[model samples]
Target chain A: MNDSLRVVLAMIELELRRLRNDRTEVFTRAVQPVLWLVVFGTVFSQLHAIPTSGIPYVDYITPGVMLQSVLFVAVLYGLTLVWERDTGILKKLLVAPAPRYATVIGRSMSSGVRAIIQVVIIIPVALLLGVSFIPNPAYFVAALAILFVISGGFAALSIIVASLLKTRERFMGIGQALILPLFFASNALYPIASMPRAIQIVAVFNPLTYAVDAVRGLMITGNLALLPLDVAVIALFDILMFAVASLSFRKIIE
Target chain B: MTFAIDARGLEKVYKGNVAALAGVDLDVKAGDIFALLGPNGAGKTTLMRILTTQFKPTSGEAHIFDLDVVRDGAEVRKVIGYVPQETSVWSDINGYENLLIYAKIYGLPSRSRKDVIHDMLESMGLRAPAEHLVKTYSGGMVRKLEIACAMLIRPKILFLDEPTLGLDPAARIAVWEKLVSFKEEFGTTVFFSTHYMDEANAYSDEVAIINTGRMVTSGTADELKHSLRGELIKFSLSDHRVDEHTLGRIRGLEPVKSVVVTDSTLNVTVEDAETALPCVMDALRSEGIPVERITTTKPTLEDVFLWYAGTTRAPGAASSIGRVEGKAGGTRRE
Candidate 1:
C-alpha cells in the first residue's frame, strides 16, 4: 500500500486497539441513545405528538437515534486531536514520512469506525424494543455507508475546530456546544416539518439533516427516491470537511 | 566535509513579532552526538523543529543529508526520527502498538515489522512491558518506548528535544544508555537539546550553547571549558574592601586574565592559579586585605555557560550583570 493508505490504516489501528483495550466508552456512549429510544420513543409514540409519515414513532426515531449516536460520537472526535497535540503524539505522527493530509483523513476515518460501534449497539437495542427495521439487508448496508460518510465529515469538522481551539479544555467546550446544536437543529430528534420555520431552514442546510433523511428513508420509510440527492450532499460535505481539515491539521502545532 | 545536518542563517519569527530563532547557523557532523544547550526559550527547540521538518523557518535554510528541510520535507522526515519534549507515545496504547504505528509510518516491510519492533523493544528493555499500556509504564519506560519507536527504522539522524526531562537520575541514565548504544550500533548521528548541564558535559561529543535566540558558542565540552583557560581562583574577603584599586592591582598581575567581584567574593581568572595564587595573596596582604577563604578550581561547563550565555534568566529579562562588579562582570557577547 501507499504511504497515505498505510498512515490511514495505522490510525484506524490505533483507535481499534484503544477500543479493544477499553470497551467502556462504547458501552457508556450507548446509554444515551438507548435511553432516547426506550423512554423518548415510547412516550412520543403513545402521544403521536410528531408526524411519522404513517409509521410507528419508534421506528421513525430509530434511524434518527442511530444518526444521533453517530453524530454525537463523531462530532467530538476532534477532541482527540487536541489531546494528542497536547501530549505531543500529534507531532510524532506529523514528523513521520507520511503525507500530512493522510494523517487528517486517517484520524477522521477512525472516528467513523468508532461511531460504527455505536450503530452496532443501537441496532440490537432498537430490535429488542420492537422497532422494526426494513427487512432488506441491502438497505441496511446502504444506511451504514451513509452513516459512515456523514460521520467522517463530522469528525473532520471537529478536527478543524481542534486546530483553532488547540486546547482540550477549549475544544471540549466548543465540541459540547457544537454537538447539541448540530443534533437539535437537524431532523434527528423530530421531523423538520414540526420544527419552527427558522429550524426548518437550518435543517435544510445541515449535513446531519441529509444523513438522517437518507438513513430514515432506507431503514424506516423504505424510500430510495431521495437517496441519490442525500448521498450527493453528504459526499460534498465530506469532501469539503476533509479539505478544510487537511489544511488546518498542522496548525495545531503552531 | 558534508555534515549529517547543516543549516545557514535559520530564523523563525512567530506571530506578533516574536523571534524564536534569530539567524541560527549550525552544523553537526555525521555520527556525532551533538547537544544543543540553552536556557528556557533559547531557540533550541525552535531550531530543532525547523531541522526536523516540524516547522518552517521564517528565513534562511537547513538541510538534513543534503535534502532541503522545507522543499524535501517528506524526504527529510524519512531520514530523521524526532522525539519531542512532550510525551510523544500514546499512553492509552500498549508499547507494541506504539512501535507498530511508527513502524507502519516509517514504511517498514510488513513481514519484518514485527521482528524489528520486537528487537527494538528488547534493545530498549521494554519487552517485558510491551503488552502493557504505556500509562502503566513508568516515566522512564514511556520515554524508552518513545525512543524505541523512533529507532524502529534506524534513520540516519535522530533528533530529540530534552530526551530526559523530569526523569529521575536512574531513569535519565537508562535513557542515555539506550541512546549511546543506538549511536554506536547504527552510526546514527544523534542531535538533542537539553538543559541538564551534566548530561551535555558527559554525553555529547560536541555542545552548542544558545542564548536569546542566538548561538553563543559551539565546541567539544572540553574545548568549551578550556576556552575559559587556566583556573578560577575564588577568594572571599572578611573586610569586603574590594574596590577598583584592589581590582586594578589584581588586573595588573601578569597571570590574571580577568577579575570579577560578586558581593564579598572575588573570582579571579588566571593563567595558572598555583603560580598566581601567592602573588594574589601577597597583593591582598600588602593592601591590608584580610582573606576569609580561598579555593582554586578548573573551569567547568557551567562556568563556560555563565561566561557566554550570561545568567540563565527568563527571556527578555534584564541582561545586565548587576550582581558582579568588575571589568569582566557581564557575559561576553559572541
Candidate 2:
C-alpha cells in the first residue's frame, strides 16, 4: 500500500524469484551448521565438557547453530550491496522516486528470508541428530520471530559496513573479521559463565548473545522467564541498526 | 519557455579535492535529443549523475523541468528516468523479472504493471527473450532491456550515460533507433552522454562538447563544423625539394589561412580551396617539387574538435583525420 511497505515486499519477491531459480545456496549453507551439530556436538556431548543443566549437548547447541547460520547469512548480506554499487545497480535504485531509506530497509529484510531458509535446513539436521525441541508450536513460532528480528538487525549492520567500506575486498576482510569475533565473544558456543571476565563483559554487549539466549530459552530450555529481557535487547538492537543504516545508505552511491 | 533541464555553475569536488565537475552550465530544450560529447573523464557522467539526482553537486544548482534537483529530488526523480553507464539489469533474473522490479520501484499501478512491461519488451524487440535470463542476451539486448526499464515509467526526461559503449555497430544502431522512436512517441527529452563523434553528429538535435569539466562549446553539429570557416586542402610532395622556404611562400599567399606539414604530406587551410590550390601548386612547382596527390574537403567534426579542444585526438576517439603529428608554420584561428 505505502511506498516503504511496497519496497520491502518487492525486495522479498526478488529474493524469492532468485531462490526459485537457484536453490543451491540454501542447501550448501546448511552444511556448516550440520557439521557443528554432528561432529562438534557428538564430541562434546561424550566428554561432558560443559554443564548444560542436564540437557543433551546436541540439543543444547541446536539453537546456537541455528542462530549461527542466521548470523552468517544476514551479516554477509552487505556484500550484495557492495557488488551492486560497483555494477551500477545502486545508481538506478537511488535515482528512483522511492524514499532512500526504503532501499536499505527492503534489502535488509530480504536477508531475513535468507535466514529463514537456513533455519528450515537446520531444523531437519537437528532432528536427524536426535536433538529435541520443545513440542510447543507457539514457542516454535516465537523462535522464528526472534531469529528474524536478529537477522534484520545484523543485516542492517552489514549494510552500514557496506556504506563505509565501498570495495568488495575491504568489505570481505572486515566482514569476516566482525563475524567470528561476534560469534566467539557471545554465548553461542558456550555459556557465558565459563568465559573469562573480560569476555563476559564483551558478551553482554554482543547482540548475538541475546539472540542465542532468546532462541535457546524458547525451543530448548522452555524457560520463558528471561525471554522478555532478551526480546527487548534484540528489538532495541534492530531499531538502532535500522536507524543508523538508513542514515548512511546513500553513501554507498556516493 | 522553461527548459527541460537547466544547470548553472554546477561543481562537484570529490574527496582529496578531485574536481569531477569544475563549473558546468547547461540547458536542454524540451522534447529534443541532447548529446553531451566529451573524452573520457571529461565530467559527462558526473554532470549526468548530478542532474539525475544520484549525486549532489558540491556547489551550484540544477533543475529538471524547473524542479530543483537537490531541494526537490523526489519530484525531479518522478519526471526523469536514468540508464547508468554500467549494466544495471540483474543477470540472474529473466528480462521480465527485471522489468517487474523496476516497475514496482517506479510505483507503476499494480494492475497495469504486467501490460506495461510486456508492451515495453515487445517495443524493444525483446519480447521473444522476455522469459530468458539477461545474462544470456547479447550486449545490445541487455542495453535495450535497460532502456526499456528506464522508459517503463514514461518520464518526461530520460538520461543515459554512454548508452552504446562497447556495443557493436549494428547494436549501436539498434539502440539509437529505439531511442529515436521513444523520443518521437513520448516527446520525452533524451539526454545522453557519449565520446563517439559520429553518434553525436548523427543523432543529436543539439550537441555540447565538454573538455575537462568545462563546457567548451554547444550548438547543432552543422554549426560546430561550419565554425571552422575554411576548407582543408590535403596534398603530398613526391620530390624532396620542398622546404621551409617553400612552405613560407605558400603561407604568404593571399588565400592561405594556415599550412601544416607532416612528413611528405601537407595540410593547408585556406579561405577558398579554389583560389588557394593553384597558388599552392604553383608555389611547389616553382621550387621544382612534384605534387603526388591533392584534394579539397570540408572540415569535419573531428577537425573542429581538434582545433578547439587540442591538436591531439582523445584516446579511443574514432578518427576522420589520421594522427596529427604536429602543426607547423600555421595560424590556427583562436
Candidate 3:
C-alpha cells in the first residue's frame, strides 16, 4: 500500500486495538443517546412536549440522537490529540515521511469508524422502540452516507481544534462547549420553524441541523425534504473543515 | 560534506518576542557522537528542535546532511532520526507494534519488518519485554523503545534530545551502551542534547556547551576543561574545622580564581596546579592547618560549565555542587 494509505490504516488499527482492549468506550458512548431515546423520548412522548406529526417521539428524535452521538464521538477524537501530543506520539508520527494530512484523515477516519459502530447500536434500539427505517433502500443508503460525511466533518473539526489548542483539557473544554450548544440550537431537538426566531437563524447555519434534517427526512417522512441542500451544505462544510484541519495540523507538525 | 549537522546565525523567536534561539552557529562532524550541553532554559531543546525540522528558525540557516532543514525538510527528515525529549512512544501499544508502525513509515521491506523489530528490541535490551504494553515499562525501557522506533529509518544521523533525562544510572548506562554500539556498527552520526554534565563528558566524542541560545565552546571533554588554563585542586583538611576564617584564608591566596568548600574538602581553581599546589600547601602549613589528602586533577566538565556560565564560587560561600548560583551563573552572552 501507499505510504498515506498505510499511515491512515495504521492509525485506525491502533484505535481498533484500544477499542478491543476496552469495550467500555462503545458502551459508555451509547449511554447518553440511549437515555435520550428511552427516558427523555418516552417521558416527552406522553406529554407531547413538541410536535412529531403523529410519529412516535423515538422516531422523531432518532436522527437527532444519532447525529448527537456523531458530534460527541467525532470531536472527542480530537480531544485525545492532546494526550497523544503530550505523550510524544504526535511528534513521532510528525517526523515520518508520510504526508501530514494523512494523519488528519487517519484520525477522522478512526472517529468515523467509531461513529459507525454507534449507528449500528442505535439502529436496533431505535427499531425496537418502534422507530421506522427509511422505506426505500436508496434513501437508507443516503442516510448512511450522510452519517459518514457529517461524522467525518465534525471529526475533522475536532482535530483542527486539538491542533490549535494543543491541550487535552482545553480541547475538551472547547469540544464540550460546542456539542450541546450546537445540538440544542439546531433542528435536532425540535423543528427549525418551531424554535425561537433567533434559534431558527442559528439552526439554519448549524451543520448538525442539516445532518439531522437530512437523515430524519429521508428515514421518517420519506420525502428527502431539503436532503440535497442539506447534503450539499454539510458536504461543503466538510470540505472547508477538512482543508482547515489539514492546514492547521500541518502547522503543528511543522 | 564533512559536517553532518551545521547551523549558522540561526535565530528563533516565539510569537510573543520570546527568543528561544539567538543566532546560534554550530557544526557537527559526520560519524561523531556530539553532545550539546546546557542548563535548563538555555535553548538546547529549541536548537535541536530546529535542526530536527520540527520548527523553523526566525532567521538564518541549518542544514542536516547537506539539505537545508527548512526548505528541504522532507529530504532532511528522511535521513535524520529525531527522538525528541518527550516520551516518544505510544503507551497504549506494545513495543513491537510501535516498531512495525514506524517500519511501515520508513518503507522497510515487509518481509524484514518483524526481524528488524526483533533485532532492535534485542539490541536495546528490551527483547524480553518487547510484547508488553509500553505503559507498563520503566522510564528507561520506554526510552530504549523510543530509540528502537527512531532507528527504523536507519538514519544517517540520529538526533536525541535529552535521551536519558529521567533514567536511573543503570538505565542511562544501558542507553549509552546501545548508542555506542549503534555508532560502531552503522557509523551513524549521533548528535544529542543533554543537560547532564556527566553523560556528556562520559559518552560524547565531542561536546558543545550552549548558553542563552549561543555556542559557548565546543571540544572534547578534556579540551573544554583545559580551555581555562587551570587545574582543579581538591583537598580535605586534616583537623581544621571549616569556619569562615579557614575558608577566607584559602580565598585570600593570590592567583586563585575561585574556592569552593564542601564539608571539609576544598576545590580551588588556580592558574597552574603544579606551581600553585605547593604554594597553597605551604601557606596552609604555615598557618598551622594540616592537610590530610591533597590531589590536583584536570578540570572537570562541571568546572568548564561553571567558568563558561560565569558561576565561579564566591569566596567563603559554599554553593550546592550542581546548582549554579543564579546571581553569578547567569548565562554568559559572549
Would you list the C-alpha lDDT of every candidate in the order shown? 0.85, 0.85, 0.80
Q: Quality of candidate 3's docking, in CAPRI categories? A: acceptable
Cα lDDT tens digits, model 2, B54-169, are: 87999999999999999999899899989999999888889999999989888899999999999999999999999998889999999999999999889999999999999999
Best of the two (1, 2) by DockQ:
1
Model 3 misplaced regions, further than 4 Å: A49-54, A134-145, A163-172, A217-231, A250-254, B106-109, B233-293, B310-334
Model 3 chain A lowest lDDT segment of ten:
A164-173
Minimum summed lDDT over a 10-residue window in model 2 chain A is located at A77-86
What residue pairs clash in candidate 3, if any at all? none
lDDT of 1 by residue, A1-254 (tens): 38888988888888888888788888989999999999999998999888878988889888888988898899787667877776777888888889898888888888988888999999998888888888999998989988887898999999998888886667667977888888899888788889989989988999988999899989888887888899999999998998999998768887
Best by DockQ: 1
Number of colliding residue pairs in model 1: 0
Query: What's the TM-score of candidate 2 when only chain A is evaluated?
Result: 0.96
Residues B1-334, candidate 3, lDDT per residue (tens digit)? 5899889999998878888888888889999999988878889888887887777899999988889999998888888887988887777778888787778766788888888888888888888987888889999999999999898878999989899989999999999998888899998899998878898898899988888877887889977665643566888886566667766877788877677877778787776788889777876777777789987776677767766754464222234432343233334324
Report the C-alpha lDDT of model 3 over A1-254, residue by residue, as the tens digit: 38778877777777776666567789889998988898888888888888877777778999999999988998887667767766667776777777777877777877877887788798888888888886788888788788877887898888787777875556657988879898999877777878889988898888999899898988887766587899789989987887899888855554
Candidate 2's displacement at residue A99, Å, is 0.9
Q: What share of the true interface contacts does each candidate keep?
A: 0.90, 0.78, 0.58
Per-residue lDDT of candidate 1, residues B1-334 (tens digit): 7799899999999999999988988999999999998888889888988898987999999999999999999899889988999998887889999998888877899999989998998989988999998889988998899999888878899999999999999999999998888789889899999878899999999999888988878899988765655577889888576879988998899988777777788888776778999999999998888999998887678766766676543221112321232113334424
Candidate 1 chain A, which ten residues in sequence have the lowest lDDT sum? A78-87
Every candidate's CA RMSD: 4.2, 4.3, 5.4
